[model samples]
Target: MDYDVFDLGDVRLQSGITLPDAKLAYKTYGRLNAGKSNAIVYPTWYSGQHYDNEWLIGEGMALDPSTYFIIIPNMLGNGLSSSPSTTPPPHDRARFPHVTMYDNVQMQHRLVTERFGVERLELVTGWSMGAGQTYQWAVSHPDMVRRILPFCGSAKTSLHNIVFLEGVKGALTADAAWDNGWYREQPGVGLRALARVYAGWGFSQQFYRERIYEREPLGYGSLEDFLVGFWEGLFIKRDADNLLAMLWTWQNADVGRTPGFDGVAEALAAIRAPAIVMPAEQDLYFPPEDSEWEVAHMPDAELRVIPGAWGHFAGGGLNPVDTKFIDDALKELLAKDV
Candidate 1:
């Protein structure tokens, strides 16, 4: 929960909507070296805040704070940042303007340069929506970023990803309590439904077949108990409007269209940083093949699939095998010369 805010005055988004007081919330770990070249920027995932990324930031980890200065920025609409729940006046709730991955990267660039005097990053890495932002960073400011490690995410939101997001949006909006995203009370029924939908897509079929829900971190007695207790519990603390804002951002995540590139190839080819894309093998939402296709178009990129049966949740390092895969990939990525 330790965080600092960077005020960028009036910030205008890609959608041409302006918020008078725009701020980014972030948390920093370790100390910046005298050389200032040891900085690593790790953005948070969907519905995740600074603390959620702490698992990858401890001692002996790939992003060990002792070896590198790590900055974890909470993406917009993640509740802790300038989100629906925290924004004021006209920009609050449903009125909050649309923010694209481009906007998030641009704002993060400002945060690093203006607040921390970090002109270049040693590494930019993240998972899920955070990984999407990592791709944006490499394309938007290639020279300023040394390397990128995007796990379980694509440079562009695939058609399948858009459809999946639409399902989430539909579930949220279908609740009578949603009330057009400005509900007086939290949309309990809709949130539960949204959680249920995520459960199906977030984990692999093998995970369910083996009844992995009966294990650590999410142990439940029955199938019904797992759905209600685990899935519902995850989304209940979040604001529905905030989740919707993130979902929309996730749906429209496309680097090619963001800055008006001629095509996807042009966007991918623009990146000069060495990128290591680690997609989970069983991740239905962000399949490994999508990353493989995107990486093929990039000037310098490598595809590394996290081998596990946990699907998209593998990027969260829920399983030991996936955690080792992440750690090994990151270590190798950082060791390379850029």
Candidate 2:
């Protein structure tokens, strides 16, 4: 209710199924200038809503709402949008049609152009699955987006990454209460199991080695406390079906799969925008090496590895140092002439 919903009205997805009465939830910061060129599109990550993206937007930060109009579009299965929990009848719960990263960006394009009258984007950036959409935007409409900064994410989901997601998905579906995603009650057991699986991959070995969770801000007494309080607590609040829906989107993400491109390199080469690809040094899922390959294919791009042991969460805005590092990068990128 805090965000505005754009009626998509029966959107046909890439899976060849029509989602009846589809809606896209989004929140905006600042005002669109007269020229409409001061816009920045910052899409949501997996299971994240518009508010979850606010950490990057502030008065002095690169995403400063006072300076630029920042748009945070919620992904389809993120609950706020037309997700399984919000949808009704046939397309509800486990029956929701599969949505791809391509499908997500296409709808976002409608919200930006048809709704806001924005033709050219000053920047398109995000983390995790949001980063996947960033790549999609730059490739799908290279002429519209001026610059991009994708952090802790990839242009294409790696084979290893897909395998990792399989484990997460398996854990959730394994619970009896899941009932093929149609359970009347929330699948608490499955969600907790999924959280446990995710805990192993979300951060680096070094993070656990140093027992950083015991420190301030996190302040957990022990490993079990951190796992139960932080990891389990995060996933338990989310709907199991919604998580599964977004997981499908993440697992199948690839710019190379776009209609015109034969492969990832070809799609990346098509992006004409200036890009700064950032990957965490200790990220288990999205390693710096993968980001290096993406930058190599991009026409104009450079890799900036975020040095930290927070792993993928380094870009998740938990650590102030990492957050500042990311903000500084965006500041430098936005200052560029291109």
Candidate 3:
């Protein structure tokens, strides 16, 4: 990936907070065709960056840069991008306002269209929260995105997901030393509690049942020790405030929001592009049933359930995700007269 930076200029978040120093860190691959219509946007997931999925970006891969120009934009709240953790003083973690996945996509739209002068995109694709943004892109700018591929994401974050994130936040705040999510001064150690909550729910019982517990043995002689080590490893370097910001964004994801659209399903129905939703059959956060419900409602949509026990992580865990699924769809979409 060719890492680069985009000076996004001032960004007014959905919270009505204006960040004058806002910028988006992104990476691009392949030569954009002279027509600039062969572009694809691949957004990042929660707690993940563009470089995190380098495995799926080689020759003959589904995201082959050889054929298409791919842009991977780091979502807001990711440290590399203009986020709470790394923002300039006065806009730091303790004072940063809330932003949603829809807000991130709108920023990306400016980067792709206003900055790069790209009139339209061949496709927009991502997993998890990034998938939520991809869905938002299709909704807000139907004429811009030619097609969409959302994997392991929901159009709107479910109430259950919101409750789960609240539980994680509660766990962190209940550590007594948390100090109302403003403990960046001492660098709160209570974040470990939050990470523990995440780890337990991130993976599934199948992971334990299948004996894939190299990091933290599922049936250790002492479960607390394993759980502690598990939490320490993941949250050891990440800041608690930054973690909470990303979780909040993930929890409040929706296709439509302020600064543009409203009514997620209505925006979705307005999409002129074909869509593909690859959901995990056993996904705990975004159930296949949800994807099925979505596909049935979308004007032109298809569903491919990844059969795995990886739960919400099935998208990355089941690497490749049948590349032909994307290839066949792309061939069909781009072949039609626009």
Best by lDDT: 2
CA lDDT scores, all candidates in order = 0.90, 0.95, 0.75
Model 2 TM-score, 2 decimals: 0.99
Ranking by TM-score, best first? 2, 1, 3
What digit string (tens of lDDT, one per residue) describes model 1 on residues 1-338? Answer: 46898898899899999976888999999999887889999999989989988877778888988999999989999998789888998899999889899999999999998888998899999999999999999888988999999999988999999999899889988998999978999999999999999889999999899888888766789888988887888898899999999988899898987565876789999999998999999999999989999989988898988886899999885677788789888999999987
Error of 3 at 104 (Å): 0.7
Judged by whole-model lDDT over C-alpha atoms, candidate 3 comes out at 0.75
Report the C-alpha lDDT of model 3 over 119-180, residue by residue, as the tens digit: 79988888888788888888878889888888889888888888888888887778766566
Q: Report how far residue 134 has shifted in candidate 1, in Å.
A: 0.4
- TM-score of each model, in listed order: 0.97, 0.99, 0.87
Query: Candidate 3 — number of clashing residue pairs?
Result: 0
Give per-candidate clash totals.
0, 0, 0
| Model 2 error, position 283 (Å) | 0.4
* Superposed Cα RMSD, model 3: 3.6
- Which candidate do you rate higher for lDDT, 1 or 2? 2
Candidate 3: regions farther than 4 A off: 184-188, 214-232, 258-262, 317-338
Clash list (residue pairs), candidate 3: none
Model 1 quality (TM-score): 0.97
**What lDDT score is found at residue 214 in candidate 3?**
48
Model 2 per-residue lDDT at 53: 87
Clashing pairs in 1: none
How high is the lDDT of residue 154 in model 1? 86
